[model samples]
Target: MSTLNPYCPDCGAAVAHPHAEGCGVARCLFTGGRRLSCGSRHRADLELDHACGGDEWTGRWPGEAEAAEFGWWTCWDGPGPEQGWDYQGQGWVQVPEGTPGAVPDLDRLSTDAQWDRHALRWVRRVNR
Candidate 1:
């Protein structure tokens, strides 16, 4: 079973040790929420990246126990098939930057919940 604890299952960083840069398991030290550190993408040009990326001494990822309390999940897009899935091109539109409620580009299986999240149409896989 995957979990966060004295050591992160993904990055293998101890509770006291700083999580590696861009570690997906890291949490947001700036916000008092259950959101992950990478809830938003990091870009060098964005002024907010410095503060959001933990440049101001925000400590390591939260431990398993604390994470469990908030029902926080390290990975939002669940597991996929062994062969994995690919992003589909249909039902997508190119929108201007900073558009509210913009659809995120997804690399997902047809059955992924993200497909339903945006009401995007998908077909069931057929066994060969």
Candidate 2:
């Protein structure tokens, strides 16, 4: 399932082929930065609407040596790929979108709650 975009920056030497599988990451855009900025950690430059252009880890080149050393793309393959990062309601002040009674309104984050201590993420409380 490895892929790559020849047009992407430094998308050469394989580096395990970065990008071209950038749909899921686009759907789970995260906005938990200091100023509620758009921050999606997708490996490709999908040019999403909510993308605040801060996904350097995926969109940029980590150099040929570093890319092979860490196998970066392998880090995001899972049932819940966006579980650990700032997606799927996972991150600082992020509320899991599927959580029962979970409302994610950046403008109305008046409360903060650790709904899932096991996951160790504090979601912003809206309308609670």
Candidate 3:
């Protein structure tokens, strides 16, 4: 199975990499993807089969283990060479830019202000 692209959780912008720079707006939306209304998309999962080598980060596959829908997963790392899952298509398909709830105009955000964590909104930061 092929993986999908990663997107910003807040504004729905496609994030080139995990922890991509300047994304104060993303929130995780993978949970919504599991619904039938959201296309009932499915992805393969790696069971940390152990044979894949140790956590030493040798950077290789799990030898004999093939792709299986064992569980949910997503790459926090950049796109893997050719793994079943990457940061993008972890366990759900990437919803397009205009997914209803997505922020249509990122420009409105100046980044001059901070997200008012209390109200869950962004407010302009005025200099003292």
Candidate 4:
């Protein structure tokens, strides 16, 4: 099995070892306690203790446009009924959640296919 290394999911930085006396928070490594640092800094304690599952991707992709452009769809309908489009352009487009993974050959698929593939891959990566 692969060992899980704790790192700052936000900045992808390695976490420093926690001090000898653990912080009251179960997973915090900083003995000084959790405090907001530079906007770029992410506290391991806060992230571990307070963040929920959904928080993992909180700021990673914050809006619908970002989701759509990057090929992310929260639901199968591709954001909404109006926005939905199918691969063949024949029926109401419905991009299912957990759709096919992103296609590296994006130039080969239609716009709808590209978005569907990318969104599925994004969701899978974040969920993992």
| Highest-TM-score candidate | 1
RMSD of each: 15.4, 16.2, 21.5, 16.2
Each candidate's lDDT (Cα)? 0.37, 0.31, 0.29, 0.30
Residue 124 miss distance in model 3 (angstroms)? 0.5
Instruction: State the lDDT of candidate 4 residue by residue for 13-103, as single tens digits.
Output: 3334322222222221122112232111444433344321111222222222334554544322233356554433333234533555321
Clashing residue pairs in all predictions, respectively, total 0, 0, 6, 4
Query: What is the lDDT, from 0 to 100, of the residue 86 in candidate 3?
Result: 45
| Candidate 3 local lDDT, 24-127, one digit each (tens) | 33221222111112221232342222121111111111110111121112222234555434445433332334343222222323333343434433445578
Candidate 1 vs 2: which has more lDDT: 1
Using lDDT as the yardstick, the better of models 1 and 4 is 1
TM-score of 1: 0.30
Off by over 4 Å in 3: 1-110
lDDT, candidate 1, at 2: 32
Better structure of 3 and 4 per lDDT: 4
Q: How far is candidate 4 from the true structure (C-alpha RMSD, Å)?
A: 16.2
lDDT of 2 by residue, 1-128 (tens): 12333334422223233233332221122332321322444435534455332222243222322323222122222235445444454233323344433332322321332222233223534555
Is candidate 2 or 4 superior in lDDT?
A: 2
> Model 1 clash pairs?
none
TM-score of each: 0.30, 0.16, 0.19, 0.17
